[model samples]
Target: MDVDLPYELQLVTDLRGHEERAWQIAWNPVEPLLASCSADKSVRLYNYQPSNESLKFSHIHSIPTGHTKTVRSLAWSPSGKTLATGSFDSNVGIWEREGGHDGDEEAADWECMTLLEGHETECKSVAYSSSGTLLASCSRDKTVWVWEVHPDSDFECMGVLMEHTQDVKCVAWHPSEEILASASYDDTIKLYIDDPSEDWFCFSTLTGHKSTVWALAWSPKGSYLASSSDDLTIKIWKRVAEHKWECALELKGHERSIYSISWGKGKTGEESLGWLASTGGDGKINVWDIREPPESSTGRVLSHKLIATLSSAHDVSDVNSISWCPREGFEDLLATAGDDGSVRVWKVVPSH
Candidate 1:
């Protein structure tokens, strides 16, 4: 069921080194580095540079994270100086360059600065806030923990949220706010905010997905959020009121469970809502252009167009994770991690 897509995903390269399933992919927001974690209990880093007309990626370092179990997720700090790894061992490891340098030559020497431990079970995902002052991690123990980042690689637990009835799958911070969103196996997405007078608490619980919610990504403007689910669908949630959000649209196309989705500012110009890319157990990568309705229209439904579809994106292997390059000039680039233990890079180009 493949057709000529409007945009072509040109193969850039395939990076193979992980010995087990690749679980996640994260691109540094301020640097040209790409990181991926795997079931092999290791995190691999790569350096990419524009080589002539295309980009080239080199395996610069491999970190054998001392976690006793699989490294499930990783995220780069906003400053691109530190990396956080969440593991099945129920601990989060923070790593930084030995000398605190951003040079590619010093990428290999990294030290685990601190280990955050509180979760009673496997940690599913970890993310740093936009200001790099707060970190969030979710676990299979059905709770989400927030950490306050301090100077000299120190961290303090700010809040432990136990609102979910089942395992928490993912946690994502708002693009420009301290508000945090967590998806869970309970088939609900909860949004939490801090009350300066009090502490962190859930302000809203979004319920629509019939099955487990696997991932969540917010729009560039933070006005809308896209979530993928085990029910083989994606739902776009729009913030209508100050503390309320409603499902604006539902996307259905994936033939299997949708495990990952990424929202990025692609070639959609400044006014349009960014592009949404999704991949999952079907081994297909689908990119959609979500358009915000005009101001005059009082309708709640938003329109979307399928711009590209790359079937068998991982060569018959389940595409576990998909991440868009967060750099300025490389907004059209995308990276995906597969169950085959390989990472592939693709460039979106206009079709003739």
Candidate 2:
């Protein structure tokens, strides 16, 4: 809790669960659920409760991903029913909560529904498309894979994109379109879209990062994409036209490799994309306020204000992942995973 934030941020809770570095954390879109995957080869799910204006969490489930190696990433389905975990073991596990029936209590039994296999090496990241019909995963094998998820947990490989020259670090989908984006160790970001023939193909490759591109996030309206990199800078890109994206701005401040970034409105009832959060190997969490373009600014000329910087965000460990809580009423809440093997929650409240 550094006192230098341009905005106020309060540490709500430090969730202790994983015995190894927690690599990723994701929030359930429609529930109090927060799930974290770790190098311990396990996924821990917690139920977050808001009590007396503070965030409290109860560990509801700890699942063995059945991987021989680190569970590196986690993604929840749009319906908030399924959790997809990617592992260094080269497999993906899909988990679901049982006993969600009418009379069941708040706690539900969790079970791994299915295991998706195919990547030759580490499955670095997994993401569900906005529609929930498609899942996209990237790997250290330097490939981006898309799957068509069917009923009864059946998944068919829709496409395999292997254009990146090095390890693919993260994959993200457009908010309202079938477009997919992947960042890689090759220092580039590639965009893909579905063709009418039911195929996914790369449409554009974004360059300019000086080192490995670690993670990516899309804006609330899907108009812009933000990327974090080993170059220690976060780059913003705007869609200039269909199939084309241009660099909007390059943000520099992190002292080491940035591992993850997320976008949030930072408002409970209001509709605004107020800021973006980025966490890095430097153990700091930075809040970059997304500002409106200047009145005289032309298209795609963006600006950002550094509103907050929380030092030692993970207590002397690299912060691996971060996500802004998607629950409508708790938009200011954030979850972060780190090398410290713990998941911490924070809430931003106006400091005035």
Candidate 3:
């Protein structure tokens, strides 16, 4: 079905069996595994094959030791060896992947490494830095805490980022930088940068969205940022100078609240197409291509082409989260989890 735009939705994987809605889905950074957490108080990990788009998922393990309520968010370490889950029980649990390189023989060796408790209310999101050295979490209590990860030592609370006046919805680490970006119900995106000599602090605030900003992501180059919001728009910003940035473009096309946004692959040259993929409450996934402006006297802003639009992508359910594979070779594949109690994988194929 065409929704007044371009883009095709092909069902690559139909991951079912969840008893409740899935709030978060993450693609493993090192392996072809997909981790998803749900309101049913369960966490599942699936092994996906990108060659033929086959999914062989087993309940590798479940968290019975941490949260007494629903599990809402999860994040995998940069090494993909550790998984962090945040839940409504007001705590975060770190899960370690046990067992040696040998397969199923040691599959029952997983364990909960630690329980991070600080938030006075339900934790909304959790993310691990690119180096696997830090983890950041946000909650409904209107606080974001940064944690330092140690191998043989106890995890330390590095710092707490307290700037949002309301609940923080999402937190993302820049691909290769020490900067972090957060979005909140206060309709703003805050950038946190650490000084090499001192602590981390809010360096800048991006104010453009008319509604709650639900998601934020940094481009792989760490030069640009993207945010999606309930205002049904996606805003792209570029860091021009030290501690200075501005919104380069505003993409308006979605009919409902946008829940997630991600950058696509093939961005390597001046003429390379930088794609933005978004999932929304209207049950659609939209792909937009950011193009450079034409050479003319009229200084028009850069334009984005609607490359793809998928209607009924979740079949009447709201897509709550979407993530692109962070590894080098898997850029064309995307994964999304939704209120439909299913996780779907999509592969982008260029039109001839």
lDDT of every model, 2 decimals? 0.93, 0.88, 0.80
Candidate 1 yields a Cα-based lDDT of 0.93
Clashes of 1: 0
Q: How many steric overlaps are in each model, in order? A: 0, 0, 4
Model 3 spans with C-alpha error above 4 angstroms:
3-7, 50-65, 105-108, 266-270, 292-300
Candidate 1, 13-54: lDDT as tens digits: 999999999999999888888999999999998888879998
State every prediction's TM-score relative to the real structure. 0.98, 0.95, 0.91
Candidate 2 residues lying further than 4 Å off, grouped into runs, are 1-5, 100-107, 268-272
- Which scores higher on TM-score, 1 or 2? 1
- By TM-score, how accurate is candidate 2? 0.95
Report the CA-based lDDT of candidate 2 relative to the real structure: 0.88
Write one digit per residue (lDDT tens) for candidate 3, span 206-313.
Answer: 998999999987766767798999999898887889777789889987799999888765433455446778997987888877765677636545577877777778
Model 2 pairs in collision: none
